[model samples]
Target: FKQAETSFNEALRIDPAFVAASAGKAELLEWQGEYSQGMSLLQPLLAAQTDDPAVLTVYARLLRRTGDAGKGMDVLQPLAESGRVSGAPLRQVRFTLGDLSDQLRRYDEAFCWYKLARQYRPNTFSAAAHRRFIDDLLLRFDSKSTQQLNRSGNNSTQPIFIVGMPRSGTSLTEQILAAHPDVFAAGERSHIGRIVQQIAPLRNPTRAVLARHAHAYLNGLGDSSRAAQRFTDKMPLNFLYLGWIAQLFPKARIVWCRRDPRDTGLSCFTTNFIDPALAFSDELEDIALYSNSCVELMAHWQNTLDLTIFELQYESLVREPESILRELLSVLEL
Candidate 1:
């Protein structure tokens, strides 16, 4: 974030009228959860660049974050309908509109905008390829193989992996857990994905390799509070690497967040995720296929892998937060 801010500032110093750099800075503030500061920066930019899709999109997102979805709708609706914007900018505008509509409970309008956004950025997610990948994981990491891998794993109970489909309440689950005095919420870490990429084709992973990767993952967590008994990695897509996680930290707690697939799919569709791995979220069919594949893989992990997995239902969490959270913490021994 510091490097990005420095780059944006340098660009602005060179060209003060660099609207893209200014917009980038404002967007960075939004990501940092500084809605008020982001809004202050964007308000002037929006006034000057009223028709600029980049400025308008960031401004609309800030408005939405500030509970002004109606105002956000008013701000973006005209630009979106003007057909003046195309490509990535248009897609962003449409997705922001979808988010605002969804926030306002205009479900049909939200879905329409989301569908339009997908048309702009076409995703080439092959379900067959994803299924094959999942099949390979299941075949390679069976009961016997995982048993051998477990012997070489780190015994640290500090790591808590919260895994599930995107928009499936992983963040909510993490927040609930992080509130505990003994737990530290690390948000979403891409360490596992990076490690898996480094050690690809895990058909016959050696014990030494598994041990080295496990150490690397723990080291990646860096320094946490000494008082923190558990640190969470709430990457929803980490469901893909649960088998590896089990082999890395056999004592680690896995919280599997489950939500109604329809709700999860709708949320994924409405939100504009910057991660390219989330390209599956572009199309509803792809989203459904990916969600089902994740479900299938998780079932295999639960059946074949010897790891503690606590299933936390989204509906249950929201409806009975206290009781459900108590049960969750108890399961994790927090």
Candidate 2:
């Protein structure tokens, strides 16, 4: 990671507005236990795009961890409405908020938030394992959804969705991208789920319904009273909604993160996630089956979407992060 950070810094020297470089460095710093510096760098970007569900979600988390509960809530308020990333981040936030609420003894509100977060992702694994497990499960979801998938997004905001199988390094890739001056990560908004929710009556929602939902969700997210522009979403499971995403946010960029099957599967199976949707948990065979399905799903998306999708390999990024990031940024035209 340090090596990658150095590479990113070099890239930024050539282009300061390089969002991926900045995001990569910031996330590296954060993971290295340099929260103060990481938050310092990310805060400005967040303020610029508080309406971004992904940015708000992560910023709110960092703020709460740094002992600014009130401010964190303030950041999260808007994004919570219609933003749609689920799995772990949502669960973690709700759990934190619930704990905070419990400390204040506001049990009811805490309960509601906890239930909501837990509604999708259960908490059975430690932090490290949770990330890995989700990767496998999300791919399973992606494989199925990517087949008949079709959805749209809010026209008001530009969405750059970062998705793929869990533990495929989507977070790492997003961090690199978000480091860029222009890119902001909205974190994981359940935009896909929100679309699904809106078209609940339809056995299968049309691409138009998905588009309307995406648009409505984004339109509702901006600070409005403030000025904020484009942002990114790292909902790995969003792969399931790619068909709709392509149709709705025609201009929205899609970054599909890829990782070695063995690594991803091992990571997924070894990790205990907070969600039960990952049917492969606790079973290596299940994980292997899921991984194969994910690769197949990716192939399907590439064939069906007819959209410009960027692919980033996790091993490649980890191996030569800056070079990979530069290529990724180039794809985003950053």
Candidate 1 weakest lDDT stretch, 10 residues: 144-153
lDDT per residue for candidate 1 within 1-334, as digits (tens), equals 8999999989999998888987899999999999898888776766665577888889899999999999999989999999799988998999899889989999899989988988886676788888898988887887777666634457888889999998999998888788889998899999998877866666556778878988877777777834589999998898998877776778888999999999999888878787888988988888999999988988989998878999999999889988998898898897
Q: TM-score for candidate 2, please give it.
A: 0.53
Scored by Cα lDDT, where does model 2 land? 0.64
| Highest TM-score scorer | 1
Error of 2 at 79 (Å): 40
After superposition, which runs of candidate 2 have C-alpha atoms over 4 Å from their true positions?
A: 1-157, 200-211, 224-229
Candidate 1 similarity to native, TM-score: 0.88
Give the Å error, residue 114, model 1. Answer: 0.8
RMSD of each: 2.7, 16.0
Q: Candidate 2 lDDT, tens digit per residue, 214-266?
A: 55767655663124345778888777666556656657778888888887875
